[model samples]
Target: MRTIVITGGTDGMGAALARHFLRAGDRIVVIGRSRAKFDALLATVTSDDRSAAARAEFLAADLSLVADSRRVVEHLQAKHAWIDALVLAASFIRQHRHITAEGREASWVLFFVSKYLFVTGLAAPLCAAERPVIVNTAVPGTRADAIDFDDLEMSEGFTFARSNAQQRRANELLGILAVTDNPDLAYVTWGPTRLVRSSFAGEVGKSMKIAAAVLGTLLGQRPDVAVRPIIGIVDAPTPGRAAYRGSKELALTVGDHDDEDAARLATAVEDQLR
Candidate 1:
């Protein structure tokens, strides 16, 4: 049986994927923040102890902290020798800015710091496996501008739109780096065609919250449907590429300067993580 580690696996897209894989007989290790959500997900899987398909475990963590992220990887690696799949579906989206105790913006930390470290820490074990997949959950966001190298933390100016743009761009950059650094491991960043309805915006502005609620009501896809791309991504052919579920091309059209920007962004990420 394959072993998979999915962050934020207690809710939304992550939870949906976890449930799907559990039923498929894969061993899952879920990481999240809420003990209640974690317990609920575990209970669902282990409801019938006699069922062969149900097998899973969980670790509670606030992923916004890099130290927590390091601890999480250590915990997982210590428990398992190899991981068949690593899903980065847990994300941070917000209207107002929030910072972690590490002095980094929560959105940036979740989207960049934690994600980068988790992959780096797990790369060795993933490579040790016969075939391993790294699926990163990303959304198509505002990509007209480049990421701010000097003020990545958004200390100077933090706007919801700007942060979204930076995070999406960061995903592509990370994907490129993953392909370059670990050629033996397959990596894909999944971009869903529709929005995922998550309770991540509880602290968002009133207007933005209303907008999310309305959009969620009108156009959101079930987390299970949205996460289908993730399953497809993991099953895709070797020589890892970005994938859009039920779509043709694997590229995310950023801009004319995306190549240069991606290189710079990768360097920045490496430096920051170091």
Candidate 2:
């Protein structure tokens, strides 16, 4: 059975994807902050499908912390000899800037650093698999110009919108750069074609949450529907680096394929972790 690892698998799209794969008889490993939520997710397995429950595993972690992210990497590497798919879906949305105990912006660590750690840290096991793939659910092609290399932490002028946009750009660059290191693994950055109704709506401020709920009601797909293309890619990944919005493939702009900028961002992340 294929081994699938999903962060943020306790709820929303990640959870839906976990259930889908479990029903398909694949082994699923989910990382999230809440043991209770993890239990709730596993409890959804039908009584007749005892094997689905048996195949599910959960790792409790706060991806917002650097140490916690690293610890997760260590734990996974030790336990799983080979991983077929790694889905980076854990996310946190804050209306105001919040610094972690490690003295970095929360989104920078959670959205970008944690992803970097997981992909790079799990390189061996992922590559060990016959057809390894990573599906990062982020806005890939929408924000090519949002990043500022000088101040990645957004200390100067921090706003929730800008921070979120910057993180999306960082993730795009990550997908590009990661493949350069391990050409055998396929790294796909996927953006939803329409808004998705998920727990992400509740994480923002009241005003934005209301807006999200309205927008989601008007133009959103349920997590199960939205996860189809992601599963398709995981089953048969595009070689090297690729980006998608729903099922449609997006051509990378010249800016998106900049090795120098991608390398620079990688170095900055390494420095931040140090």
Candidate 3:
């Protein structure tokens, strides 16, 4: 059985994927902020299958704090000999800018920076695995222009859509640069164009909740159907290529300058945080 570590596994697609993998007999180690919620999911996922529950593990962590990311990676590194796949599925979309103790916006820290930290810190186990894959659940709202090199933190003016698109772009580009560093591992960034009505969809306000539900009903697919691409991504082999997922094959594109951009992003964020 493949050993997979998933972030944001307590909710949204991560939780659905966790249950799916567990039922498929894979060892699932999930990271979230709440053990109580995890316990509830564990019960539902396991159901009558006690063995499946036993195969699953959960680590509670507030992923918004980059300071805690290292500890998370260290713990995972100590526990597992090799991580078959790392699913960077944890994300947040907030209407307002909330700066953390690290002085970076919470959206940037959670969606982009901490994701990079997880992969960089856990590079060892990832490389040691028979088949190493980094599956990033990235949204395709904005292109490369989303990142403001001058205001990476969006300190001047911020909108929820603007910040979310920026982080999503960062993650997609990060997959591009990450493959160069870890040639043995495959980096896949999933970009589902239609909304999936995830847990994060409704957390903002009532209007957003109604919008999400209506949009989901009209345009979005169920979690089972939407996550099929992700499952395929983990199962397939596409090393050193940053693959984008969508309905049409023509939409899948890669970048030639992602290495430089990823380096700039990495250095800027690391330096800023320090």
Candidate 4:
């Protein structure tokens, strides 16, 4: 069976994706930070035939730190020589700006930094796979803000929208540069305009929670439908671009942004990493 590695596979979009892949007879190696959620997911798998547990494996890691991300991949490298796909669905929304232990913004670390580390670290095994693909869950219609070289963290004015925009742009640039640099592996970003349900909203304040609910009911689509792009891309990924919620071939790379801009943003990201 082909092996798929998923981050944040214990809940929300990640968990939904994992269930679908598992049903397809693929082995899943999930990386998560929550033991409770992991156990719950395992319970769901094992509840229907205990032997199904063999098809699933898990590793616990706090992906907010770059070092920890590398360590997680190193651990994986020790176990498996090849991996068919890597789906990064790990994310959380912090209303106020918070800095990670790595001195990076929490959302940036979760959404982009950890993903970059995971993808780069697992490059060798990915190349070894028969058909390796990288699927990233991106927020659709995200504003691709150019990273301010001076204030990368936006300590000046930190709103969820602005921070999320920064992270989304970083992810886009990373995909562009990575696909260009590593032609052996195909990368696809799945952008859904809105998702019907999100576990990410469960941990927020009551007001935000209400808003999340309203949005889900009003503007969102079912999780399965919202995740259609991810499923499609995993089955067949385009090397250097992304797909939105609707339409198969008609996709906007980085959500209708420019290729040259993605390249320039990649350069800026490289500089930031240095």
Candidate 5:
């Protein structure tokens, strides 16, 4: 059976993916912050087939903290000798700037840093597997200009839109750099063609939450529908780096895959983590 590790597997597309893999007889390890949600996911999946419960595991960590992210990496490394797929799906849309106890912006840490740690930390186990793949479920093909190298954390002039855009670009760079660093593994930036209805309403302001609810009702796809293309890619991933919106491949711009910028961002992240 294929081994899949998913961050944010308790909700939305992640949860949908977990259920799909479990039913398909794959071993699933879900990382989430809430034990209650993990238990709920386990209960829901097990209700269908008690045997599937043996293939599922959950690790709790506040991914917004660097230390927590590191601890999770260590734990997974200790437990899994070979990981077939690593899905980076954990994120939150913050209407206001929130700093972690580590003095880093919460969005940057949760969205980018934690993912970076996972990809790099689990490299050995991932490469050990046959047809290892890393899927980053984030907005791709975003303008690279959105990222401000000087203030990656958005400590100055922070806005929800700008922060979101910056994190998206950062993830794009991550896909580029990871493939360059690990040519044997596939790194894909997977973007939803349509918004997927999720629990993000709880993280935003009252006005944005109402707006999101209206938009989600009108334009969002159910988590199960949104995850179909992602599972397709995970099953038969192309080597190296690529980006897709649903099943359609996107062309990358010069800035989107800049080696210099990718290296610089990696260095900056290393410094921040240190």
Candidate 6:
């Protein structure tokens, strides 16, 4: 009987995770940007079992806004004092850079800003869990990239590849920092080998879409297969850094990129968040 909170829960990895967790009898709260999708998922969950009505709740907001992230934290905290797990599966992947109304790059806001606020804002509640876990979904694309401190939002020279890479890098650093700053909390930043076929990725530009399609067709694994290991990581007796491939732990952090680069990226992220 744990409370699990997932962003971007209306679809894709988030949705799949919600279903799996619900079936396992964990209370879940899902936040998404679409009311229709939220309602639709709620309807299905309720239909499966009326008890799901009591166990599950849905909220809709564009997380690109810091205010919205704050509101989400407040709303959920008001409902429950403790959260067993916080999974940030929401992502921003666009071919062209889009600016949020808040004057920050939309993709960066989604990947970095919203994620940071959610984790920091909910730290107390999440820490209340017997064994709390914070999981940030990331990819190998993060590599060993350097953060552009001068243009933190990538407003000056933005590209889909660079923006996505930076966010993935940020995810890794956040995991390390979260673990280091709060010794009681367990953190894991992992990437599945398969591309999750989700509406979230539908917003990619044409060329990128073609590239994704090709990669997905060639190397994509089913969503369930990709997410099973994450569930295991969440349920592990103790968590620090766990990587997985098809429910088996793999060495994604080993030799894929340089340790120095990852450390520098983590430091930059800490400074930017400060």
**Separate clash counts for every candidate:** 0, 0, 0, 0, 0, 0
Query: What is the TM-score (0 to 1) of candidate 6?
Result: 0.85
lDDT value, candidate 6, whole model: 0.74
Model 5 misplacement above 4 A: none
In candidate 3, stretches whose alpha carbon ends up further than 4 angstroms from where it belongs are 201-205, 246-256
Candidate 2 similarity to native, TM-score:
0.95
Q: How high is the lDDT of residue 206 in model 3?
A: 76
lDDT tens digits by residue: candidate 3, 93-177? 6778888887678887888888988878888888888878988887543576678877888998898888888887788777666
Q: For candidate 1, what is the TM-score?
A: 0.88
**All candidates' TM-scores?**
0.88, 0.95, 0.91, 0.86, 0.96, 0.85
Most TM-score-accurate candidate: 5
Clashing pairs in 1: none
**Ranking according to lDDT, highest score first:** 5, 2, 3, 1, 6, 4
Tell me the spans in candidate 2 whose CA falls farther than 4 Å from its real position: 201-203
Alpha-carbon RMSD to native, per candidate: 2.6, 1.6, 2.2, 3.0, 1.4, 3.4
Tens digit per residue, CA lDDT, model 1, 224-271: 887776777665536665555434345565577766776787678777
Superior by lDDT: candidate 2 or candidate 6: 2
Could you tell me the C-alpha RMSD of candidate 2 in Å?
Answer: 1.6
Per-model C-alpha lDDT, please? 0.76, 0.86, 0.78, 0.74, 0.87, 0.74
Candidate 5, residues 118-145, lDDT tens digits: the string is: 9889998898889999999877877778
Q: What is the lDDT of residue 82 in candidate 2?
A: 97
- Poorest stretch of ten by lDDT in candidate 1: 241-250
Worst 10-residue lDDT window for candidate 6 reads 252-261
Q: Candidate 6's residue-wise lDDT over 118-155, tens digit each? A: 87778788878889998778663345444564577786
